[model samples]
Target: VKVFGEFEFWFALIKVVAIVAMIALGSSVIFFGFTNDWNPIGFSNLWQHGGFFPNGIGGMLLSLQMVLFAYVGIEMIGLSAGEAENPRKTIPMAIDSLAWRILIFYMGAILVILAIFPWNEVGQQGSPFVVMFERIGLREAAGIINFVVITAALSSCNAGIFSGGRLLYALSVNGYAPSPFAKLSKYGVPNRAVMATVAVCMTGVVLNYFVPDKAFQYVMAAVTFVGLMVWIAILLTQIQFRRSLTQSQVAELAYRTPWWPYSSWFALAFITLVVVLMGFHEDARIALVLGPCLLGVYLAMFYIVGLHRKTKLSREFK
Candidate 1:
């Protein structure tokens, strides 16, 4: 896991560098026409295709799920907080700077891509970044872009492994999962929990191997639903935590979420909107139904198996 963590760090750095390079190269193409025989490309493509809102406000609103999906990495900050050496300082800084980073990296890259190529035709062949680099007479760079993309994918997998192991370990400690998951190796690693997480993830790989086509879509739909639920839970937990604090305690806190309760409420509303919008998309609609049903089953099991009783017993003993 430690070795994987190192690789993950470098993979993330590569992704950041690749995005910055793409944005820089794309900007040159947009303004200076670095690759288009010195003829500037400009931002005409954004409006020329369908005047900014090709499919209208509804279309834009419907895309919130995909946008939210891209922001899933933000949740990793909270997941990693338990292991953070100075969470009070680091977590707050990470949370505060996330918006600016997203604007500069995600929004900036999208702006560059749209400016350099027509939106509709951008992903028709492959990545817009790949096409842009190829157009810039850097075929070698385009090939490297593919390698960078693969690393980015692997980085996501690395995150899944890290987060899943930690989460299972936490659950086990809380008496919600098998006790074996709470065990730690000599290196303080949850080897059992990590192996279990990998086994669960491997099922998906096997499914992909067999189905080849529908597996990814199905997995994504489930992931989106699970991600939405996780975000909603986090916001709810934060609201409850704030409510549990007295005014003096709140005032003494080193970190606070800006706008307090209102921002959290808005987040809940936005998540609710995304959940509703999911029903409109055929591919994602199953999640809307299945997600709640699964949650219901889990809730039922909590009582049926007397896990709640175990929790109360543990608290009393403590």
Candidate 2:
């Protein structure tokens, strides 16, 4: 576990460094004209094309699917609560920083992209970052962006594996899965869980080879639904978790979600809206169906494998 955890940590570090570098370089180009072809492009381009909401309210709403995926890993900080040196203090500090960090990273990057190019053409040829660099006549900028994107993909995959592995380990420990899966390897890694995750991700590589570009987009859309499910689960978990605690305990919480039930419900509604929007877009519709289907299958397996029995035991104990 330690080795695998360290591996994931380093992978995440690489991704953060690459993104920071891209942001710094991209911002500098906008601040100072990189070449004659690209004058010091300022904020004017944001409204020059079709205005800030060129795609209108609908487009902005649709863009949330993409934006939400970028924010998926934000909750990883919360998951680290159990291991934190002082979770009460650290968790609140981390959550406190989330809003600003997201606004600066996602919104700031999008703003830069829009400022540098028309919104319609932002992702047409490729990534907006690559396009921006190429426009500036930076010889190796495209390659650099490509490299960064590769690192981003790796980081995402690594995080997914780590998260899934831990989830599976928890399930196994709770008798929801085979006990053997809960056993750690010599290096303390949840080897079985990691192997399972790697197997699923390897299928992605195969799909990439056989189906290539279109497959990736379809997979991304489908996978996004999993994100929505996870968010809903978190909200539900928090609600249940809080319900089991005393009023005093709640009041003492260092990192309480603001607005209580209202904020939770609002977030839930937003997630539902994203799902509905996915149905409107032909490419994302498959995900809407597949996501539910996958959940159904998991529930069925839970019952069939006697996990339901264990759950009943837990409830009885509670």
Task: Give the least accurate 10-residue stretch of model 2, judged by summed lDDT.
Answer: 309-318
lDDT of 2: 0.76
The candidate that achieves the highest lDDT relative to the unseen native structure: 1
Encode model 2's per-residue lDDT on 65-170: one tens digit a residue: 7667667666777667756789888888878887887676667777777777877777789888788778777749678778878877777877778878877776
lDDT score, candidate 1: 0.85
Clash-forming residue pairs, model 2: 1-188, 1-189
* Top TM-score prediction, candidate number: 1
Compute the lDDT of residue 206 as modeled in candidate 2: 84
* 281: Cα error in model 1, Å: 0.3
The models' CA-based lDDT, in order, is 0.85, 0.76
In candidate 2, residue 135 scores what lDDT?
Answer: 78
Model 2 off-target regions past 4 Å? 1-14, 29-34, 37-39, 311-318
Check candidate 1 and list the clashing pairs. Answer: none
